[model samples]
Target: MYRGTDLPSDGLIAVVKRDCPTCVLTAPVLGDFVQRTGLAVYTQDDPDFPETVPGRIDDTMLDVSHRLRIEIVPTLIRMRGGQEMDRTYGWDRAEWERVSGLTAIGPDLPMSRPGCGAKNIEPGIIEKLKIRHGETGLASRRIELGGGEDEIEAMFDRGWSDGLPLVPPTEERVLRMLSGTARDPQEVIGLCPPDLVPATVEKIAINAVMAGCKPEYLPVVLAAVEAVLDEPFAMHGVLATTMYVGPVVVVNGAVRRQIGMNAKGNALGQGNRANATIGRALQLVIRNIGGGRPQEVDRATLGNPGKYTYCFAEDEEGSSWEPLSVERGLPQGKSAVTVFAGYGLQGVVDQKSRDPESLSRSFATSLMAVQNVKLAPACDVMIVVCPEHERTFRTAGWSKQRFLTRLHELCEISGEELISGAKGIAEGGPDTLAGKMVKKFRPGGILIVRAGGGAGMFSGIIGGWAASGARGSSPVTKEVKT
Candidate 1:
């Protein structure tokens, strides 16, 4: 089990076995030789075997046996310090004599195979592993900001970022952003996952700035960092999953207007800085502090563009129903952000439907399709109902609960509709929309909100596979900064 280098400068021979008659018979002679030569003697079954021997032995010997294919009894091992120098099995008297030579064991011996002997590792390989293990004392490494462009590029080339150009986080910039918030820069926001590195407000602001966020967006970013670190969120799993899940930020209250976030037409698309940067800022924090870079530990397959930026405001003014935050029991007029690890948007456009029932039916039919069924029924969904559709629902005198109830009823399908004949689908099932929906239907899975422009009769659905069950989807609300 011992590597050769783990041994003392002066070599020692250790005989190991548990309850073996041969070992018992040979103990006295071995003990005398050990005492005379001042060599270390170790027994496999001795209560204090590691202390008595030059080489340590434990359960790891079993691991070593598996690696080296050792399957014999009465093993005699030679060591210096705690490393194995040489080993022999089955009590070969000639081999024992050869190992017990007066001189120290030479590296030329047949047993001295690279790591087998106490060879020091190459410095370059050791350094690489240290970096991979995050043992560079990275936390202690001063956050240097003034590296030249070449140096910055080198850091990127060395696989440090999430495949985008970074805004150099100068000390001045970080401090200026920190000044926007009341929290201490050194105060720990939370430990980012995969690496479990401490995320200070200073670090968060630096990343937020890197993500092109304005100073006022710092509070929302801070709250998001806090929410993901909440034990239930399991940021580690979310960050590491092979699924295309990324954080979708939903903003509410007066902050939406103050920050100039888009809740109107193409809110999920581009053209709004506040919406884009807020979500981008959180993602940057996750990448920089949380260590969730794509393709490394991130491991997302067919990752969504939302991985870039997915944040939008609730269109409270256009909505006929209550806002999402209020539905989750937050007080009216409270500014908050609801974050979800979604697989991106599923656009539900129905320009032909004017009646509430027709619109609801269209949405339900779209939702019961194959892609929507990818999510578990118990999972929470964010339904972005456009103003045109909301107006139609209001004109029909349908409450939000009524819409939710109808949606739940319509979303249900039979087992045959769910099967896609793909590897993910259930075996021996029909491959229809009704079958798919029925297989994964759960009541109260829809989360409705009013958003988008008055021009289109379109809405969008953001669905998830599972509810994260007391762990995920507990939307955290933080007051937006002025």
Candidate 2:
């Protein structure tokens, strides 16, 4: 069959038939040449074409036969200058070359032999064939380096980071980090917020490794991954918000002791490996996998330093009350992690408060004041009460539930107080279910936990706002297996 040749410099012809073994053998060889030369190639197969060859329709071959008579089962026809000149039949190793005018076929050419099928081919050649057939792989390549200073600086000048030198995530470094995870490299973890792009576990590990996380820290990273994936958490919205909300991780149970997470003085500040790296790992996962790079999807206005690394442990021993994880329905013996999308913390200093009511009032007021600013009244807040403050509540016979109840009572604010110019708090418009709840809860919706060193009278209040439409209220807790 003759088809108009628009570009004669790059074009060729291939002939074959259905159920012909020799024709089948030469088909792949011709296909390879057509791909390499960037030429047009079409096949003529018999009516009973095998089911093995893909994209082979009966109408196509029939149309070719109707246009041109093909008396032979296997034929090699070369078309040049808008005419078919060279024609050959049967399998002649030397004649096949003469008809096609191919001087030398590459040694790495992927061609099917007389008795071979596509399934029995080597992986490298199979990959080449698949690529020729238009199959695409994942875009997991590294950003090129070694550019001129101006070009390199241009990338940074675009507001890519927080003005600090970053560790380039090379493919080799990423692969090594992926070796620590048990999941398949291609398995999807969840969509990261703002962009809502799918992130595989391997990709998360790659960023984690680039963030300088040790292999042992992978589980904590994984747990944080699971925490963000929780629906209420709305990681996508959190990432996209202009608020300074960031993922704050709190380790509890045996994992804190195992990973040596800092739970005492300066726990939130830095200098501890586990505390720093675990939080950094999650940030990297968000930055790289979720594509929430700063100034892009992560639109935080004056983003807090905790965005770099904000992980700590609950001082279980120092507190007289139940640990945070246990109060959140986890068993005391089981290790767990809690993640909050929060703003910078406000320290609640209460040296004079010796009774539970006084300490609770101080914490409740701090939570309410912070809650009144940006967060919806229905949104949850984290109160990091120092161990000494917890001791006062314990000495006054306050149970964990009692403390939560007292804080809930003391934190209540009127609808009028909540309606005053809070950034994320939805105003009373038509009054939907969410709006009614926001008005009803006011400041009583705060979530409080006892943590930190026993010597300190200060507590840290982590404020949160509604993200992706509503507040992510549910705290996800997964037991860390030994």
Candidate 3:
């Protein structure tokens, strides 16, 4: 693997590209430096630059520029023993003269004209340069495509997609994604599901790149991965169950706004990159690394659209209650990701409810129907309170705990009503209790968060897996660390 070029032990290496106007203005100054001092001019774009000078090397390949870590055109470097001692960029008169040990360089020019960005710093160029220079220490296998092969079609054929076109996980992109977090790329977080594949930070970054995640979203994606892989989350069961369920990620704290996650107005729906990709990245890791596919380990009979990707941020700022992460035991002001085995979205419309009691009842009515209306404690639920709906609770001086307590109270039903064939509905609870009250959710089974737009008096309920509590997957929240 090519590392970088080694210049002479003692001399000045001046790097310039033809595209930069500053380099054009500074070309005459270069000829003077070469004649007066031990200088080697490396031209990034054109070799015939500065016709007045001889012995200038053409560095149009950018190998030397990348080797020297040049970020701007017209850069002057003083090298000693093949190591850079001093460097200066653009047309800074005094700075360039000092670096080159030459007097009055670029005297006719102004104080400085900021040089153009180096070619290696261009969007897709640096990655290629990194790969060519062999800087990335990625451990994943490299798959080179045929010259005639279509990259997009190739990924689908290889079963690497979740029914959507994915961003190619090129080495450069993966390396860029890894820059988001300070954790060692090779550091193993834990074993991923089904296949029990060891998941490393680098592997997760590869999936994050494929998921179209920006570098900043990598920490959140990593947190989501860790949360689901948690022993309590029961990710394998969630994937293997025939129930129409998948992981629904809820982000909280400062990260929501920092990553530009959608906390308002269609927060759960499409159009937000961070929301969509962070969720998708986790699934891709499960699919690619854990080998959990639809017909494979993931046996969801009729999966919801969220099986593709369902993630959103809680509207903590507009919420009347504490942030979901804080309520879940994270310290205030920190960021976290909570993963829940959720089935589908059920929205509750209560436009007329001006008070907490009325709205709470409306939410209870919809939540009670979860799994089955006649069943008792069948599944857990996640109630996403909208801004307008939360207003009703805040106006009535109801805390989040108070609202949840009332929801559990209102969800209580007679054991006789829940017993088999009580309401003419076949799906019902056992007949152990002849006349007793049964709670709709077990303790801590009801998860509530604030989301959605400001205008709508609506709230969403994500019904949890029927196998709730110690029996199945419960919500797992993990801190997002850099």
Error of 1 at 107 (Å): 99
- Which candidate model has the greater lDDT, 2 or 3? 3
Tell me the tens digit of each residue's lDDT in model 1 across 268-341: 88989888877888887788777778778898888888888889988999566888888877888988777776
In order, the Cα lDDT scores of the candidates are 0.66, 0.63, 0.88
The superposed Cα distance between candidate 2 and the true structure at residue 403, in angstroms, equals 0.6
* Steric collisions counted per model: 22, 3, 0
Off by over 4 Å in 2: 1-139, 142-163, 168-176, 371-378, 415-444, 467-474
> For model 2, how does the per-residue alpha-carbon lDDT over 462-481 read when each residue is reduced to its tens digit?
87655422444445566554
For candidate 3, write residues 195-280 as lDDT tens digits: 99999999999999989999999999999999999899899999999998889999998888999999899988999999999999
For TM-score, the strongest prediction is: 3
- Give per-model CA RMSD: 21.9, 16.7, 3.1
Lowest lDDT 10-mer window, candidate 2?
Answer: 115-124
